[model samples]
Target: MSERPYVLLSCAASIDGYIDDNTDERLLLSNDEDFDRVDEVRASCDAIMVGANTIRRDNPRLLVRAQQRREDRVNRGLPETPIKVTFTSRGDLDPQAQFFAAGDIEKIVFCASSAVDKCRDRLSGVATVVDAGNPVDLTAVLAELAARGSDD
Candidate 1:
């Protein structure tokens, strides 16, 4: 594994600084080239991250489906799927959402202690929610993931 920061920051936004529109709708303004680029980045990194709102609205699978990304992951030995991560302070995640279902590998949902009770159940299939204790520290969450042998 390469020595890299535990947190890998990334986001998909419109050309107008909005992840979505004004109606709780999901908007993906990223072009095919941009999507390919994101796939490549995800292929190289250890984890792909987003906020809770991003996950709830978009329900992203966060996996690279393009041929190039798969080939790149093959070259890097990074696994066919990137670690899907979410930062939710209250653990207010819906486990039945497509975001959880679409993963080829396990999904990690990071929440605070207050959210653990909420996270402990309802999340099934190939995903698990992790309680990071009080205050929902993503820094600590990333550190823990890093310690678990993630490359970046």
Candidate 2:
């Protein structure tokens, strides 16, 4: 079999298994070193994924922040970073969220088949939304990206 194209879930977390601890409380637990390491991992990954909770809670820019790596992508003619992704089983992604306004960064959202009308209407090309059966399927998300020239 061929080596499967990998999609990475790279997230920062606190000791309590959250992308951030005291999530609603908005306490910071990560340092610059941790963020740099995350940038390094993102430089190598084909695509990155996050959950609805993570997106809504963070309102993150979601771009790799390493200047050196951004230059490398320019040298190689690759994208500034890998695809940024979000998952919402209902397809009810937040269009007004900061993530949607990140220019030059490609985003993909995965929704349950039944949620197509519910979510897609609000989002135009802000992100590509796919119906991956009910309850949402991560595997289908990866496959869709791969087919669209996003795989390694």
Could you tally the backbone clashes for each prediction? 0, 0
Least accurate 10 contiguous residues by lDDT in model 1: 1-10
Error of 2 at 38 (Å): 0.9
Candidate 2 residue spans exceeding 4 A from truth: 1-3, 11-23
Task: Choose the strongest candidate by lDDT.
Answer: 2
Worst 10 residues of 2 by lDDT: 1-10
Error of 2 at 96 (Å): 2.2
Q: Candidate 1 has what TM-score?
A: 0.81
RMSD (CA, Å), candidate 2 to true, equals: 2.6
TM-scores of the candidates are 0.81, 0.83
lDDT of 1 at 80: 73
User: What's the residue-level lDDT of 52 in candidate 1?
Assistant: 87
lDDT of 2 by residue, 91-151 (tens): 7677878777874877777878888877888888687777777877767666777776666
Tens-digit lDDT track of model 1 for 1-152: 43345455667776667766777666667889987877777777777777888778777777777777777777867677777777677677777676787857768888778867667676755467787878877667767777666757
Q: What's every prediction's RMSD, in angstroms?
A: 2.6, 2.6
Give per-residue lDDT, candidate 1, residue 44: 77
